[model samples]
Target: MLEEKKFFIHEDWVVVILAALIIALAVGGLILPVPEFNWSNASELFQTVLEPRNLGIIALQFTFVFIIAAIGALLNKRPLKGYLISFPIVYLITIAALILAGNSQVKAINLEAVIFSLGLGLIISNFFKLPEWLKSALSTEMFVKIGLVLLGTGIIFADILKAGSLGLIQALIVVITVWYFAYWLCKKLKIDDELTMMISSAVSICGVSAAIATSGAIKGDSKKLSYVISMVLITAIPMMIFMPLIAKYLGLSQEVTGAWLGGSIDTTGAVVASGSLVGEEALKISTIVKFSQNVLLGLAAFAISVFWTYTKHPNSKDPDSKPTIGVIWDRFPKFVLGFIAASLLFSFILDPATVSSVKSSLKNLQGLWFALAFTSIGLETNFADLFSKQSKKPFYAFLLAQTFNVVVTLAVALLLFN
Candidate 1:
């Protein structure tokens, strides 16, 4: 006698209900009347996205992201790391496409961001080890650049220029100088190059994500990546809290303060949080400036890849022995191309209505997806690899860039935006 059994491990109803909940909340947050419990005005959600009160709501949402990221600690020991790695990658890719395409089909859930983040998170939780080839720029760091590219729809470059071109110049100076300082300090300390780079970039750039990306770029050991992320996330909480105090103490104008915070902070969520606390004008100005620098990441990554190819390869000893164009192509991640393409296409092709729609949708989804993505990052990386002695060099590199980033960025912020 044989008993027939259904082969389902999870309930379809539960998946449907979660999906519905996410979607309904996202859309309702934007379309329906928000309960008076919070000050969110659904009617004005799209029109006044940059308003100070709305910015507060956005900040409130990011709290969830931080919590999930902290929970990543739960998955540290087991098979979760592998799942952590891949889930963020895929989830990020989807959000990129959705935002770049300018579709605000959903509201609060940010279907695209959630899909990419949760999917990636699930994968990373289940599987952390990757093939040697996948570990290179292809899987992690390059995709971060890709995420930045997709984020361009939210950035209106013309608005940035109108605000102040030198603002961008200041930001670049800050990011580069801090990075250089971090690098030099690490080298003098004889810290591992890969880990140094991870920490430095994460600190200098957009926080945990950048740290993870650089770790992959330099073939940093896993433990190095974990510790660097830990340092960045932990320090970020305080930086976000204290930056407004520094801004006001320095007597910076709202716009100037915006530029300063945007330029200085490592995480986008943190920047937005700090900026909103200052004033409405600061939030708007800071977000735009921060995005401008974000756009530069692709070029930086490319430059780094090229530099590494020429300087460190076994064939570097021979003047004529260089990576063939093919080898260069092979080593470089192709995902960045998709990111660049999305930026250029949107920059030239999209009209106002389309861009508006795209931004609205992404705005709604951005924080939540980012939160989930970082959680996945936390899940995959570990305390062991992050603190390892082998991480000295990468740590040095990351440290170098981040130090330069803070000083130079502040100078630019004060001079131009002031």
Candidate 2:
């Protein structure tokens, strides 16, 4: 029998480190004079990097990522030497991709950093066989979980409150409606339960993160997860670029357009990109709506887990035995709790000025974590597996569901935001 791997630390320790890092950064921002920076334009971002202060920021980022990668190496029981050597290369590639995506021309087309990083990694992985040691360090799930926890720091409960009942209602309607539609469609197309859940969650909530969360809850196939992720990413690009243009052509108000984009776009990054194309008000409203939807991820995962577990084991020897609170708690994604805690802490505990300062300083770090995760995803995913014959049904199911989402969300945005 293969020996089970041992780790110096449990996986949960990574979550603690992520939480501590966010809190430390937030507190540090309050005490330190952090430099103001922008990546709004590619040329400007590249120029900014040459500045001493920005260079220091970059070094700090590298140090933080190195520590995280080291921890990942330990958890996977891998040789630290190879991981240390390869991590910098991966990090640099992801950073370069981010810079490229931030360029004025790329930004105009709304090609996000996540897409660039994934594409770059996919090209390298497909064209050349990567070293086994390097593959060992590609901890996509860990990076994504850390990113999600850090992402919580940016979500302020006050913002959700400010968005009012309409935002919550719209999110509820879109998530529930889209999720069931996708699930039912997949079943009709004879897709497996695992793939159906993954696609449904990706369509209804946030994209990659939601798919990851649901897959964990259902213990779905990694290749299926990658397929759903690819579907979301590919569909998101066109939606991100064209949605704003369509809104403009229809003469929709910025708020309505923002809500529509937020509800329809699978990824938060894509929603923000699409909303930015519309206007400032659209960007703000889009973020609020997206957050409102994201807040449902934990709940959705838990619900699916219960449904999966009970349905699969319906004839349990003890028919009287039903899933308990323990089951629900176990099924819930802990990172979501961290995200919520971070959001609540930033919104309610911190003073406004400190919160603002912290948000500004730490925002890019979250993006970097997500970029790394996407790069890892691309590196691990084989294009052939993602587009296999078994995936055809899921592809059609996702396409149909997302089209329905777009139409329904647009109508709801008009009714609520307009």
Candidate 3:
């Protein structure tokens, strides 16, 4: 008798369902209010961020997310008891990170909450040994996939086209050129395929998201994913701070500068920060360009999944034989489907009024999910593992690829935007 596949919903499908439900709830009028985290000082921190109303809002947000996460855990057949006990602790840590990120000084430096989340978790994990239950409860991939799905809602195709056709054109040229260059460089450096893929995607596409998508598609090690994320975040800081100054020194036009920043910078937050330093037009153009790239994430993930399935799957019985369509389908990440579906719904199906109304709420939830995922990643990662001697080659490759990305994006930007 063939085993009953119908009874078992794959974790990827569960992620898709959970992501859909979250979007449906938001669009169906359950608009969760985003809590205020902006604070200038200790006084304002207490008076504003920690005020009764804000605290209540935070509590409500936590409850909503916790419930959704719990449902995901249940559907995925995770140990509910451990997840229940551990998730709140993670949320508390993430809240502290959010508060830290809200500080005026932190905001001034363009430090994001996810950085703090990762840092705090690293501090805890490195300092003390964790219980097995807590370790098992870390649903890093689940959180990330759900966040990616939610991310799709913000990638409204019309918005990208309306903003600038040049932005989309630049995104395509930059991503394709940079990805291949990065991939070839990593291969030449003899970095393992997993790190190669993650590093390549990070350099060529939107940094963290690309890395995450690649990792998910390939079933990569979380430690490697964390390493790639750390590199992206760390490299992003200097890029964000100094790239605008470089643009000004070169006397580049705001449009070219924006295109360069958006195309080259790994992270969206960094792109925005760098663009803001140049001018309002730079910021606008940079954001449009970034969104154009963001719109390609689902397609890239699908392509990567198919490629990985065909070429690198370890379980293939015959190394020379191409996998059947059913085998490929089985190996494909279902969350990418959710991502594409969400993007399509937002792009064409939803009315502007409905989309506008629910967008902020969904975006907040998306950010929170990513923050949670990073916290889990940090907790699960060992500092030693990330910085082992083996990582040096990939690090060098990433820096070199980023440099290539910067040069190529600048060339593309000047050619198109100029």
| RMSD to truth, every model | 12.5, 3.8, 1.5
| Pairwise lDDT winner, candidates 1 and 3 | 3
Question: What digit string (tens of lDDT, one per residue) describes model 2 on residues 262-285?
Answer: 999988778888888889999999
- lDDT comparing candidate 3 with the true structure: 0.91
lDDT of 2 at 261: 92
> Considering TM-score, which of the candidate structures 2 and 3 is the better prediction for this target?
3
TM-score of each: 0.62, 0.87, 0.97
Local accuracy by lDDT, each model = 0.54, 0.79, 0.91
Which structure among the candidates has the greatest TM-score? 3
What does candidate 1's lDDT look like per residue over 1-418, in tens digits? 8999744422112222322333334334532221111114554444455456654654454443233322332322223454355444544443333332223333221222333343343355447664533233122332233234345445566667776676568657766766667766776777755655665566655665555445544556654565665565545556677878988898889988888888877767677878888999999888877776766665656665565566556464675687777666545534344445555545666666655544555444434344334444544554455556665555455545554665677777778877
What clash count goes with each model? 62, 0, 0
Give stretches of model 1 more than 4 Å off.
1-149, 212-223, 314-320, 362-372, 387-404
- TM match of model 2 to true structure: 0.87
Better of 1 and 2 by TM-score: 2
lDDT of candidate 1 vs native?
0.54
Backbone-clash count (model 3): 0
Name model 2 segments beyond 4 Å from true.
1-13, 28-47, 50-53, 75-79, 249-251, 314-321, 324-327
